[model samples]
Target chain A: MTDHDHDHHHDHSELSELELRVRALETVLTEKGYVEPAALDAIIQAYETKIGPHNGAQVVAKAWTDPAFKKALLDDASKAVGTLGHVGRTGDHLVAVENTPQRHNMVVCTLCSCYPWEMLGLPPVWYKAAPYRTRAVKDPRGVLADFGISLPKETEIRVWDSTAETRFLVLPMRPAGTEGWSEQQLADLVTRDSMIGTGFPKTPGAPS
Target chain B: MNGVHDMGGMDGFGKVEPEPNEPVFHETWEGRVMAMTRAMGAAGAFNIDVSRFYRESLPPTVYMTSSYYKKWFLALQDSLIARGYINDAEVKQGHAAAPAKDLKRGPFKLDDVKRVMTRGSFARAAEAPAKFKPGDRVRAKNINPVTHTRLPRYVRGHVGTIERHHGVHVFPDTAAKDAGEHPTWLYTVVFDGAELWGPDADPTVKVSIDAFEPYLEPA
Candidate 1:
């Protein structure tokens, strides 16, 4: 098949096939009283506004400044995260894997898109796409390179394939030159990819 | 089942495109689909395992081509139809033809949205002592059933070291078939890069998977 043939599958009419199917499913469910339309709005609103990587940044910030919290987080992540009211949905059974100079950690769901929704919000499209799922486990170095990250050959790259219920969160190393930085300032450096182990946290003064 | 969804160690799809400042949902319908799927789960229409099975049940061609939310949309319809909640006519007409079938739980409502969104615990009480512990060597079982299973094909028959015991959790193999939770011990099994891929694999890498007791045997 030509490249044009493959691209044609993604082309859509005025009402895309998926759009029509989703609308139909929602309408029928609403008519049957299985799903409340208002409830759908609530769910959507929460994900869009209330929940996101900012919540995870808070946890990372706390860990960076508080040694006690860091220990608790690294030891029992679910309990530690719950103490901060971040426990919900996919955030259950959370495990925090810390990155040191000698080791790095990355998380993927090879079976499906099993992400820690409560911690980092919804996963990005690339994380769910077939390429990331397929290559992250095999050629992690190449995958890391795609994100413009090149760890030293000495550092070990550990890829966590979330095949079961347990979810993983990467605790990226704290950047240097922030001796007296506040927790909020530290959090501003944490990006979603940093927590996913695809990119490093922004250095001080780097644009977000 | 060895399905297309088990996409570990495979390649040649494309580069990982990172969209800068991507929104939670690219489109309105995607959010609607997400909300509907979550609402049905909250209403106990189906468990996560069963929902996953339906997604895996899609034809390889459709599974490969459909977008993420599209797959969820199709699987949600499949589960709802299988459970008699809605039918082909209802989905096609965009309206219910008959009275609604009572859900396993009540209709997910606005009042309990937060509570429902807080996922319920899948961990169950351990029925017996765990068969494996941290630092123990175990091999992923090679058996592949035509029915639902959580063991990905790539890791099957591969030996790895037990990193941590995650206590007893619902076993997806049986749960997906509506057989029962059949709670079992779960662990984090860490395999070396050379163990999973060949020697050509990046030597500085390792892969870890959350595995149930059923999928492992003492190496």
Candidate 2:
């Protein structure tokens, strides 16, 4: 399998028909002066590089290493994340849910795609898809299994349905054998899926 | 109104397929749509709730057929027309019939994009004291208005406990109607999985929803 396949499950050979339609629509809108190309690039660049999953990874790593920061994150995620310079978009009222040995947390926006964009960036394709939206709440374990995550049988799963203004971020447990690791090292272990509660953080010495 | 967007307990959509090495966006058009939606939003063409209502109001077939960005494109088209930014003729003909009207400000500049995105309006305002507090029993009202609403149909009329108050924020039901913010207390309500999905659900799973106060009543 290719490196891409190893990262995620699905593959698309070419752009779909809907994508072509959107292209045409965009061209028309741009020509009509309703959208500015430079502005588009700016917005895309901000989410793509400057503000994304890495921000959340840093937040997770800090929470794992610092007890007081973890308490602040759990108490008022919006204000705590702001202290780390991550704030905006659906992140005004943030709530950090910690995943302990006994309770696992997962996030899904059933009504709409209300993600913590400033911290986690734009949500992944699956997070916005219909199946994940419905199944995450209905069959939590089954959904986790699809993502190759299997929690202990006794662990209680709490699915946070982001129906209103508050956005959720799942604080995954720190992996074993990384006790003395620095925050930067721990940040590298935190993956995008871990914060979303679809997968776990990378184990120490494991191939990323 | 039970819109197609409310896909909580319903079935038949199939599996959640994660795209391999998915870029921030799939294609150029998708990126454009995302940018346009935000730029237009910044331009004050429409509020977030109105934009959401546009997507929710789409025909079920169209709603299902369109991709995420495609829906945004379609909704942006509707918003542009409704807000007098563009007309149906211009959309169909692929060209503007007349010069676009001069606005107080132009589309977002590249320099201000970062600041605009990071510094979004909170929209939360001080209102009356919350009717319910943490650990209070409440039931989601079953009212299904044809216009925009944040309450999902699956949780309607269901009893759940208020986990915590989320402070007062804009109520989408009135926001979409262009009435006002109609700020209300929001809460995170937790319901037992069995309570929501009946006996077939796994008792170990619990579902929590961020519910606005108007959607809830003392149970």
Candidate 3:
């Protein structure tokens, strides 16, 4: 393979330092025969196209509509999620924390970004940044306020610091007025932040 | 190692600003870095704990300034070199000068992507019985090692209740050092927000963490 360069859009001068370093890293590894470029492409393609939070949305949707699944998910999240065929890296040992009227559950990986990638896909930039990591355990209410969520003062906020292998998924309380909605309809209302405990699922008839 | 990455409770970093409709990857290089890291990991270049140790061991200045993927990229290079798969000269020249070093596994192929993505569990059968159960009061030990560890600095020496018991799992503290897979019992320990912080802490907040058996003791 004569030095592959798919990035033909810009000259060397236009490429940022980080961009060039990434290209160089790949080149060296490929030349060493330690990695296949096709395999890298496949990995990227999987994250970019095949897997994501929508998978979690479907699981959340089913839990909202099915009573048995809701019980099973809260009991053992990894096994319940595996039943739906959503088991993989970063999602091996998942624990689903439910949000109730008396208590709310949120997740933050203060040490490193240990998110459930198989369920929630890649974490957002904010979730991985220093600010959220530092403040979430200290001032979770303030963090939730940044997300425009104002919970009742009496509602206990449970902040889960994902320090070990067990990843947490906040099972947001089902929004009202969707009594007869289908799982797909309910899933559409499930935002990534809602599952992360930063935001709630969209209200019925609200913009997606 | 109590590196800058254990950023819990300390102030001054600024507010959490979420990007609206954030793209999966901020830059093309970021996606490539992620893919390369994953692919190399699949080839058995290094385990996740070792990779994290490299990232955690970065100088405070570099660790604080680098973006998440940038950290991963730098860590991947360091891990590759440290594992003898590549060297600084090859990294700088952007090509291999010497014969490729043998890895524990061969090059990660495209066909292997699917099965690899469906990763296996880290949980192992317990060699001994669990010491505590849900509702048991326990305290996080204050001991800090100079190597890779999952216990954060904030929770050290603090008391919390064991809310749930997860079966034994691979201990990162040993795994990162090329030590044996000494699996141990894990639990979800819950702490009152006021206990973690001072009395000024919000009345509604409670924090929980997954603590391995070694990191905890009977309260």
Model 3: per-residue Cα lDDT over B51-156, one tens digit each: 8999999889988877888889889988888888888988788878878887777887788788677666899988999999999999999978999999999989
TM-score of chain B of 1: 0.98
Point out where model 2 deviates above 4 Å.
Answer: A1-34, A85-91, B99-106
lDDT of 2 by residue, B113-171 (tens): 76667645545776788899998999999898888888888888899999988788888
How does each model score on TM-score?
0.96, 0.91, 0.95
- Candidate that beats the other on lDDT, 1 or 2, i.e. the better one: 1
Residue range A33-91, candidate 3, lDDT tens digits? 87788988888888888778887888889999999999999999878887875433344
Q: What does the lDDT read for residue A47 in candidate 1?
A: 93
Worst 10 residues of 2 chain B by lDDT: B98-107
TM-score of chain A of 2: 0.84
User: lDDT for every model?
Assistant: 0.88, 0.81, 0.86
Candidate rank order under TM-score: 1, 3, 2
Between candidates 2 and 3, the one scoring higher on TM-score is 3
**Which candidate comes out best when scored by DockQ?**
1
Q: Is candidate 1 or candidate 2 better by TM-score?
A: 1
- For each candidate in turn, the interface RMSD (Å) is 3.4, 4.7, 6.2
Name the candidate that leads on TM-score: 1
